[model samples]
Target: MKPFSKLREECGVFGAALRSGEAAGLTYNALLALQHRGQEGAGIAVAREGAVFCRKEVGLVSEVFDGRALESLGRAGLAIGHVRYSTTGQNICENTQPMVIEYLRGRIATAHNGNIVNALELKRKLTEHGCVFVGTGDTEVIATLIAYEALRAAAPSPDPGTAPADPAPSALSAPAAPDSAVEAAVVRAAKQLVGAFSLVVLTPDKVIALRDGTGFRPLCLGRSAEGYAVASESCALDSAGFTFVRDIRPGEMVVITPEGVTSRQVLPAARQGFCVFEYVYFARTDSVLDGQSVYQARYEMGRMLAAEHPANAEVVCGVPDSGLEAAAGYAAESGLPLVSGFVKNRYIGRSFIFPSQAQREAAVRLKLNPLSFNVAGKRVVLVDDSIVRGTTSRKIIASIRAAGAKEVHMRISSPPFRHACHFGTDIDDEKALIANNMTIEEVARHIGADSLGYISPAGLKTACVHGSLPLCMGCFTGEYPLFVGRHTKTQLETR
Candidate 1:
């Protein structure tokens, strides 16, 4: 059976460069904070004394990294970690990230957090050039490309049978240090990429943070008394006691070394395409993305939603978690009382991960139950981040009605998904998306809601106006930032 229907972001990446203390432990804590971005698998790679040790598995961070696992990683001053929900590969152990590649020059570890549109094309070229691969994930392909570039740069030019006379010492410039070569190699590899990616790399001498040219994914630089850190979101930095340094710009490369931090624009940025859904649903409420507060954005979205779609309801209730803040704004704007209408089972993981139809249905039921006291006998404005397939939303509204609610009105904080997302978001088949085929009124009827309203693209822009750049609404509109070509998750996996 197909998995439960919901939009899923690819993954989250965290990297730390500490002057002292265990970087691996800090990475673990940061990964916990980023767990919401991805929950299928977790991994961490630590560098110590010029050696990189990686521990990864197909499970939650807490499940995969026990006391023994952390100890096995040993003490390290530099580390990078990743939590993954596969968009281009299966949710298996081999695809878990922090891909460590050992080359003639040195070793480097990479943790990536987005999909690569041309990964298969790049993989084919690499294979033709005799690059062997282990995992089917795009991250491995990326790491191998970096290693290939670094090695190719470091390798002595193929035997020119007749050697030219050596130039005078003063006439020739010194060869690049291993660290400099690796940084340049990353820039080269990044320039060849054609999709969303915010990745962190642990080199032999430094930690590198690189974001795609379009800034399709969020990545930031942070600092503390000990050293510097880079994370997919600012909230992860906070978990490790790091204060927010400025966000890494689009196509920028920030290298953290023992000497200090240095930055350069590795690739000239294309159009600013930061994902708008980060505010709508993906990021943690506490995270600040590209100078905008996630919580503030969601609150504003809710306020806009209320203004656009006023529900004649007595009480406002948010779908648990992401929807709560928006619900608060809706309640505040509509002058309706905001109450917790559902009791959530905190221990249950995201319902979308359940594989079987029966299991997914059960997960939804076990995950949240309508609180009869608040929702019963009252008109309810039900606020949620989105409705992907309409199945979960239908189930939720049915549960509320079963609890005796007089009327349930549905409100979404973002525009409907009318197109497929070519970036990291797993909005694969347009045919599978409910909004793609059904009109607003049709969707409302299908989902059993008395009324339904979706925040307009304009309203979403207004709410997220604080962002440093323009938003990517390709999933809402057909216009995308880059040439998506014929890329799909299935093609990425099979190729």
Candidate 2:
């Protein structure tokens, strides 16, 4: 079992098309801003002189792409990068992305965020047609799919020495236009995908960006004097010194080249299923997703949580990182003093893979230590994003009690996590979910909290009302925006 009881999103993706300067360095900075999304692996692929060069490894962004590695990629006008925490494949170097594939047309590098639900089906078909895979992750499947479509579009007719099929004519794909065939291929490949995905494809001449029909993941456009940038969140754009442009609309595909940018409606708009957890936990607080401020959303969640489950405590304290903003809102709404209850060690990464239970329990303190001065002899209301399996919560509440807190009343900012997330957020097993087996009171007792309260689903939705799209509350409500069936990470990675 893992030590930390938290959900994990799959990956963060970034792409840049610059008129001057090396894109690899700018992409590195963007990945750093997005490091919160994933830490298991990092990669960057640069398109240079009709060739693609990529460096990827199973480690954090800074660890994987040191100065030497970044320098080795050389200066390039187009680049795409990824930071990954595996939801579909094992955490190995082979699965680390910005998957660079050499295709019939040329070389293209692709970075992806979000889960592809029908990956297995697609992979089987591709395999039957003699496509061999070197990586187990779905991203390779997606990249190959695009390459296959592009090859199909450019293939000659079956008849004797006939000319190749005309590339489907559209505003973006004018007949006989070789440059736009890749864009058409992207559209065709996107139509076959069944779940959440935001893709950035780096070709020698241009970068292409696409989002799912339902917009289950976030993707946005950015602009600089040099050129355009694409990222999973607006915070990365800010980190890379780019101005936030409008979000790439649901089902929209934007092609960025040195000449400028053009867009095509790759997939028709489905029911807007923007992942609500982006605001609840997955995103950086600084990010703006689909026009909603993640910080403001969390603040409102805190306010709503206080209204719905006001704690009888002398001080309000949030779990470090994600909980701090909500805790501030809780304190403001409840008229309680907001206090720092824990000092987090910034160096420790997620403690989810300790070898033993004893070591796992001990690792909790290595990451966060209670500030005994603030909590001692005070009734403390502890706010957190959510409790996954209750292990970390138990450890945290125990530490607060040991610190001489009079009481530790736990308040959760989001609704209970009950179902498995099949859209990129990692949940080990639905059966392992604490809420699946325990009642609210039982969970509170299990976590050793004096009292516990969870914000209602309605409250969570209201908290994120600034969002332009409808929310996907699948994990909380067990009713996904699209068909998920009984898919699991284990199943996806098994073969």
Candidate 3:
């Protein structure tokens, strides 16, 4: 058992092409801003002098990348970085990203967000074609597929002397015009892939940003004095001192070079399936994804939750990090006083890699402690983002009760998580989820809460400011945006 009760956000990817600032250093800062997306592993790959220099390890960004590691990456024109939580792979260094590779054409390093639906089938086919893998991670698999396709698209027919094939005359067909071919190859590879993905790929001269056709994951483009930056959230862009540009639309790819930026729509315009949970939990409250402010959306979620599930409590307090915004909304809507019920340790990283469930449960108290002075003898309304296994919640409630809280009403900002998330969340299989088998009342009892209330499905939808963009609610609804199913979360890691 993973010992985590909340769904883990998969990965955060950041890419930059800079004219002045060092790509690696600026990206390190960007990763720090985007670290909440994942804490299992961290990595950065820089394209320097046409070869890639990379340093990656399984740990939080700060813990994994030391001053020497940053120095090893040095400065480069183009760089890509990733902070990962293992949705598709296991928590291991081999699964850490910024998956770099070499091919007949040149070097390309890629950092990816989102999971591939057909990764297992793709791996089988690639293996039969003589591709050997170092680790069972979809990011590495994707990098290999892109490299192979790029080489294939650029390769010409063999000659009698066994020399490389000659190129045609047009700009698009010319061999020396390498970036165009690579971009086209990337677009082709993107078309072949199914399911959600947001990729930031780095070559020697350019940084490429891509989003899946349906845009199940967030990827946005921004501009800086140095050049361009692409990240999982606009907050990372702001951290890098970049001006917010529009999102890299679904099915779109942008190639950024010293000459400027060029765009291509690989897939036709379609309904956007932007992840709604980004606003609900994963994204920075400051980020605007798909034209909607995440903070405003979360505030709306709190208001909606209050409208549907009103509680008679003296004070409302949200979970330390993401739930805070919603907590404010709840307080404003219900006219109840809001106060801090628990104080979290800012230095403690997410315990995704704890060796055992017992250790993880024990470590929970170290990360968050109840404010006995505030919570004592009060009817406390505890708000949190979506919960799964109920292990962590039980711990939190037990501590609060031990501190002399009179009543604890558990309120979730999102609906019950009954289904597995196949896109990028690590929640997989009904057996692992307490909600899959237990009713809301049963769950409240299991977690030691006095009462429990969840935001309804419609309430969750209307809470987002994503006006017309369709959102992926598959995890709560048991309906997927894409056409793939039955695969296990750890299967990719097992390979």
Q: lDDT tens digits, residues 1-495, model 3?
A: 254567778899999888863889989999999998998899999887867778999988899888988988877878889999887777788889998776544577888999888888777766666677888788887876666556445555332112222222122212232665567667756766777899988877888899998898998888877798888999999988888888888888888865578887777556567777887888988999888888888888888888888888999988878889888989899999998978889865554467887776667668788889888999988888877888878888888888889999988898888877778887777787888879999999999999999988899888874644688888888776676757765677666
Backbone clashes in model 3: 0
Error of 1 at 118 (Å): 0.6
Best by TM-score: 2
How good is model 2 by TM-score? 0.94
For candidate 2, lDDT tens digit of each residue in 1-495?
Answer: 132368889999999999975799999999999999999999999888877789999998988888899899998988999999888888888789988777544677788999988899888977776677887889988987777676444444343112233333222122222446667777778878888899998877889999988998999999999999999999999999999998999999999975578897767786878999999999999999998999999999999999999888999999988999999999999999999999999977644577897886777788889999999999999999999989889999998899999999999998998887888888758788899999999999999998999999999999999999999998999888898776665555655
Per-candidate Cα lDDT values, in order, are 0.85, 0.86, 0.81
RMSD in Å for candidate 1, one decimal? 5.2
For candidate 1, lDDT tens digit of each residue in 1-495?
135377889999998888885789999999999999999899999888877789999889999999999999998889999999888787778789988887543568998988898889888977776777777889988887776566334434442221223223221122332776667667767877889899898976679999998998999988988889999999999998899989999989999965579998777786878999999999999999998999999999899999999999999999989999999999999999999989988986543576788775656668889999998899999999999999889989988898999999999998998787888988878898898789999999999999999999999999999999889999998788898877786675664
Q: In model 2, which residue pairs have backbone atoms overlapping below 3 Å?
A: none
Residue runs of model 2 more than 4 Å from their true location after superposition: 1-4, 155-177, 349-356
Off by over 4 Å in 1: 1-4, 155-177, 350-362
Candidate 3: misplaced stretches above 4 Å? 1-3, 155-177, 269-271, 350-362
